[model samples]
Target chain A: MTIVITAFERSPDGGKGLARDTRVRWALEEVGQPYEVRLVSFGAMKEPAHLALHPFGQIPTYEERDLGLFETGAIVFHIAERHTGLLPDDANARACAITWMFAALNTVEPPILELVTARIFESDKSWSAQRMPLVEDRVRNRLGQLSRRLGDAEWLDGAFSAGDLMMVSVLLRLRASGLLDEYPNLSAYVARGEARPAYKRAYDAQLAVNKPTAG
Target chain B: MTIVITAFERSPDGGKGLARDTRVRWALEEVGQPYEVRLVSFGAMKEPAHLALHPFGQIPTYEERDLGLFETGAIVFHIAERHTGLLPDDANARACAITWMFAALNTVEPPILELVTARIFESDKSWSAQRMPLVEDRVRNRLGQLSRRLGDAEWLDGAFSAGDLMMVSVLLRLRASGLLDEYPNLSAYVARGEARPAYKRAYDAQLAVNKPTAG
Candidate 1:
């Protein structure tokens, strides 16, 4: 069965590869899986059809045969569980790798997303400037802990499993904010992830979709 | 190997069962597994010892033999995978179950956490009052979609899988906000989760740890 995933018709990031689909596409690339992408407009995303696949009406819903799944973390894990490259063979190492996946999405990403909401949604509000520091500090606190745990390690756990893939992807969101630069190891980690041939392919593919078309 | 997990020494919710450990505890109960709990103070959570187990320095962290794991979702998932009660046997159904878990943490809970931040952390800020409605609306948007998907169904998918456990746990946080009352079906769904024997045992166990000692 062909794996079909949904992506934005035109990503809000404008080809920056920050969209969740990039993460899924990257996972597929790492696992040597060829998948098809269906672009959905923001308006259509909230339609009943899309909502049936994703309760939250979000992009990057995965469909294969009779199975449908959403949530980037879950989709990535689904792909990783079936494919060998994204998970370790050792039981303990695999559990640790899975731990990092949750840590990236649950513990680390929330504060970064709060910063995004503060910047984009609340920028016009009276207290946006004052509140920005508090939000950024929250992100910094998590990053400090993450950097400390990462220490000088090349990847989060052992080799570059899905954990590193997710951690790198989550950290990439901080680059534009300059917070990632404050943590040199994390900066290098993201660079390593970007340098991967598979990551490069996924990045270019998503870019092609979001790029402006000539008249 | 003994399964040990961590919880707040004194939960901010004061035995309200909102702590992540309760979710793990409930899963264990459902699986008919007994476990030990280690209570950690807020200060200790930031220390290197706890940070080594959980980079984010939060509860509950899972330790069994040499393999230690953190992130409530990951820990709960670890337990669910080893045990039978929390997940379906069907491959597609299990994948959907995991998707709902991610949806609970990533999609639904972020806005709710923001609301918590707005109310607890940012309450004194000048923009709290003005910004709250927007935050609440974000939550309502997600809830509306969830309720639509749930319709008259007892759970997100079939049976009370980990997905329902997580979704119910996530939605439980909204009760204090009163946002849950807007959707009657969602309110009933949470009631069903709380009514489960395993959930009651889990809730009571955490309450015992958190309840103040008598003079």
Candidate 2:
């Protein structure tokens, strides 16, 4: 059976591939898997059908044959688990890589998301300006520690496994904010992940969906 | 080799067991594993030694023999992987359960953390009140959908597993916020998780650490 994933019909990012689906796409591309995209409008996402697949009414749900999955971390993990290149053969290394994956989502992404909430959703609020700095500081704190640990290392761990993939994706949210530039190594690390051919393929695919249609 | 984990020397929660270390302690109890706790002061968390164990300078890092791990998600996941009770034996169920784990941390926890940041760190900011509603809405949106899916169901997937453990942990952040009561099912669900023997043991252990003179 063909693998199918849901994406935003019109992404809030205007097709920058920042939508969670992009992560799934990148993973599939990395594993050389062919898949189909099912575009979902914001309204459709909130409806019962989509809610059945994803309780949170979010984009980027994965369905293949009898298996249906939600949560990008889980989807990416599933892809990495079934495929060889995304995870190491060694048990310890694989465990470490999985650790990074969780770290990226659980530790790194929370602050970055806060930055988003402060900047976009709460931008109109009276305290937006003052609150942003605190949010940014929290992001920086996480990044600083992450950068220190990553000091001069190529990837977060032994090799570029799903961990790096997820970490880079989480860090990418900070790119537009310019806060990522503060940590030179972290910035370069994200660039490295983006420079991958698989990432480019995924980026282009989402970008295409984001493009405004010509009259 | 005996497994060792870290906890706050003096928890700010004052024995309420809201500290991150409590989660790790709970996971160990769930797996029926006896582990040692090495309490660290907030000052020590940033030192080189603790930093080596936890890049983010946070609590509840795990170490056994040569393996060292950080991030509560990673540590709990490690325990779940090593122990049988935390994860299901079926492959698909296991994968779905793992998906819930990510959903808890990645999707659900972000907004809850925002509420924390707004109240604790940014409470004095001009936009705090205005920004809070948005964060609360985001959380409610997640919880609403989750409640609908969990409607009349005992657990997220089949039987309770690591996924519920994580989801419960994520939801617990909302306890003080008073938002959890908005959805009766989710409230009851959290209560159910708390009622677990493992969760009680974990909660009591952290509470013990916070007892006066324990340090």
Q: Pick by lDDT: which candidate is best?
A: 1
- What fraction of the real A-B contacts shows up in model 2? 0.89
Report the lDDT of model 2 for residue A90. Answer: 81
DockQ of each: 0.87, 0.83
Regions of candidate 1 where Cα sits further than 4 Å from its true position: none
> lDDT (CA) for every model shown?
0.92, 0.89
Instruction: Write candidate 1's Cα lDDT for A47-134 as tens digits.
Output: 9889888878889999999999999999999999999899999999999999899889988999999998888888998888888999
Which candidate leads the pack in DockQ?
A: 1
In candidate 2, what are the lDDT values of residues B1-215, reduced to their tens digit? 89999999999878877888888888899889999999999999999999988888889888998888888888888899999788998888888999999999998898888788778876886666766777789888889878988898889898999899999988998999999999999999999999999999999888888889665
For model 1, the DockQ equals 0.87
List ranges where model 2 is wrong by over 4 Å.
Answer: none
Q: Which 10-residue window of candidate 1 chain B scores lowest in summed lDDT?
A: B206-215
